[model samples]
Target chain A: MSLLRKGQQWGTFACVWHIFDATWQDPFRSAHLIKKYLMGLYKPIYHPLNQCGDHVIVINSKEIALRGDQWQKRVYFHHTGYHGGATWTLAWELHSKDPTMIMKKAIYSAMDGTLQRRFTMQRLHIFPDDNVPKEILENVSNQIKQLRPVPNRLHEIPQEERDKIPRLIQYPSDYQLK
Target chain B: MAALYRVLNYLGKNVVLTAQNRNISLSAVTRIKEIIQKKEGNTLTFEAVIKPDPYEGRFLKPKNGACAICSSGLDIKHTDVLILSQFVTSEGNILPRRITGLCETQQKRISSLILMAQYAGLMLRRSPKGGLLHPLQKRKWKKFNSYYDEKTIKARYK
Candidate 1:
């Protein structure tokens, strides 16, 4: 029941601008959760084309949550064209080697081929520690500026976002059709 | 009629060249002449301008470097603005024609140029920072990893 509650809460997450240092959760699992939250797949108004997602930064990657006897049972395998060059490593070993890589790979996998997916994956700035650089926070808005929250039908802007000058859209001049 | 069409076409291209760069649209003029020839039962005499395009003199200066975008514009003035404006994005997508406001003719040329740059590895193919994820990530709960789905599995297995 507790697990279900946490999962439910995670499903409707608002954009939290904080560092992820809560626990030693498996970044692999946490990355998927992060991807789901930021990709709009879990949102009420999820549209495949609509730009809807939040910027997520996972800091202190060295510590993330994990479950099961995955450290032993889980083995990552990769191949090299040369025979007998196949490489394998356990999750426990990889986590220590580079915790940042694990989450980076997982979140990357979740995003897939969407423009928003690209934005989400790209927006995910990871650091080994809890402190985010000042430059990153400043540049966040420019990163996700293209993805519109809602489709502009009349191309009207709400009172808040009207400060940015958008290209004026107009109906064809009366002389055009004639 | 064919001659008149060629004359009018050359006149038009020359006018554009005169104002901008030395790009005389030699190909366009050739195309117009060819088009006129293709017309059956042609009644007009054809005339090709033997004189050099006037725009070339203003835009292209052998003593002074010519503007790549406009040969006719003095000192190739607009090249810097044009080149900077057309810089490719990190992900390989060439900026599209609409926002750039380039005419169809110039747009086509720019597209070809961008493609060459990308192919030569001088430019990146505007791709997202992280690559696409295979479908198996979402479907991991199902215990099978795959790029294909049920429809594909059914087709292949059957």
Candidate 2:
């Protein structure tokens, strides 16, 4: 809930939510967290090869916080799969590359390295902002959830192939408004 | 002679609990393992006690989120072996039974876990013998080259 005030800050559209560690019985207050906890519980029993977990949409991606000077030091890696193709982009620079990565990495880390990790991760959706056309929210655990985690256009580019694709094409054309 | 008899009895589907305490406390620790060191009784080797039912055939199929046990559900301490075994193995290849001393059935189950980990990007799909480094990558370089083809390069120079 930090106010937006920056020198060169760009806002993004994401399916954002606050990840609270503790559980809440008030479904309306912390419905998304409750659902994530429940879905995570099912992961031990459910098949990992197939998409079993539900998508968690994060809104207001720009508002997410970092504990310390972590934002300035944190870096994301992408390899072209060639000699000297490894590119290290910072947390802020990646906002231009793909604002959603910050959220995606967060969810991916939580899943750890379970066998169903690949399939269960498919359901995770991270949007930068809420200013999109006809946003779909479904009711699951006593609270409404963003049924679809990803935007209409998903980033299917491989890690090695990301540099080949133009950054402009990464976001939906209408994202300027958000 | 008794050790051979015990092995034969266990493999032949004859439970010999009627004999003296069969739990003979196998020495679980080996020089080869550099993984987590817990109490001696906790760490059992794949060859030492793993008894997978080869006839079952169903254990070959990996369950969702579960690692391969003697072709059965995830066994204790064996979960720790899942990550360590993959790390010790040379690369993308799965470890076979003969060297690991695991029975045929348990070996198959562990192999599937390796495949699943690779698919999840936790492990490599191929070995690093020669393929780890990509070399001789030739891309269309236009540093000082001419017109239309050199447009992007020219703009960068400016």
Candidate 3:
């Protein structure tokens, strides 16, 4: 095979490392996206029995955003295989106890239940913050686009830009300035 | 009858005397007189001239007298702090409908969006004065990033 064909073959089979930044992203929605990559469904040769899945490195998992009071509303249930061992934890409480747990569980539940599920999960990595190990960081070759644009805080905006934005309302005459 | 007539006459005289006392002021004081006085010398005087707003004509007024927000037809989200901040006072209260010129539905929607933005920490800078901290500096659940769905807003702005 020519050098070009050889390189193409290697690329198709290579377990590429993909990085996803979870800051301001909804974990549940992003789980489906991340699952696609982890399962290597993006590959043309993807098959249920194929060992073609890639590794996904999720960073800033602690900064994940949940929609509309889900932090206090959503509950995670756990059982210890014994009588009266059931426990339920709110989303925010679980996050506080383990920042990466929510993101991990989100992606874990997003995939189908199969014998390969455990092995597939082994390929996924999550970090509470952006402080990934240098060895793992160096292996990452692709960045997964964020599901939504990270909203900017008002205070983070520069004063000049704030002034340049067009005014929508003008105070009427005789209006006292607050 | 004689004593009642005497009491009535005494009350009438006292009322006239009090009215005379109340009228002893040099002149009536008003906001317009105060502003004119400050502009001129120490002597207060009334001026009927219309005061021009510094931001007059800076914004695009709605055609046919429609509300500014209604005419624009912008789907504003909570994260749109720049647009949201325009509807709020410097002290962080929503401007009244009379001044905002927004319709009832739009006013309600904007106020709700402002509240959501404030709670989500998107409008932290515009929050009321009192040692307000950044989102990262806030306590436990609040310190973590959170976002709200505009659909969850109780006020429907259709």
List, residue by residue over B37-98, the lDDT tens digit for candidate 1.
23347564333334332223223232243323333232211112223223343334555554
Question: Each model's DockQ?
Answer: 0.04, 0.01, 0.35
lDDT at residue A101 of model 3 (Cα atoms): 97
Could you tell me the lDDT of residue A128 within candidate 3?
A: 90
Ranking by lDDT: 3, 1, 2
Cα error, candidate 2, residue A124 (Å): 1.4
lDDT of 3: 0.84
Q: Any runs in candidate 3 off by more than 4 Å, and if so which?
A: A1-8, B1-54, B125-137
What ranking of all candidate models by TM-score puts the best one first? Answer: 3, 1, 2
Which number leads on TM-score?
Answer: 3
Give one digit per residue, the lDDT tens place, for model 2 in B42-80. Answer: 764332233332224322443453324432443422123
Best by DockQ: 3
Q: Kindly report which residue stretches of model 1 are placed more than 4 angstroms away from their true locations once superposed.
A: A1-19, A42-45, A110-119, A138-178, B1-158
Give the range where candidate 3 chain A is weakest over 10 consecutive residues by summed lDDT.
A169-178
- Which one wins by lDDT: 2 or 3? 3
Model 1 TM-score, all chains together: 0.33
Model 1: DockQ score:
0.04
- Alpha-carbon local distance difference test for all models: 0.46, 0.39, 0.84
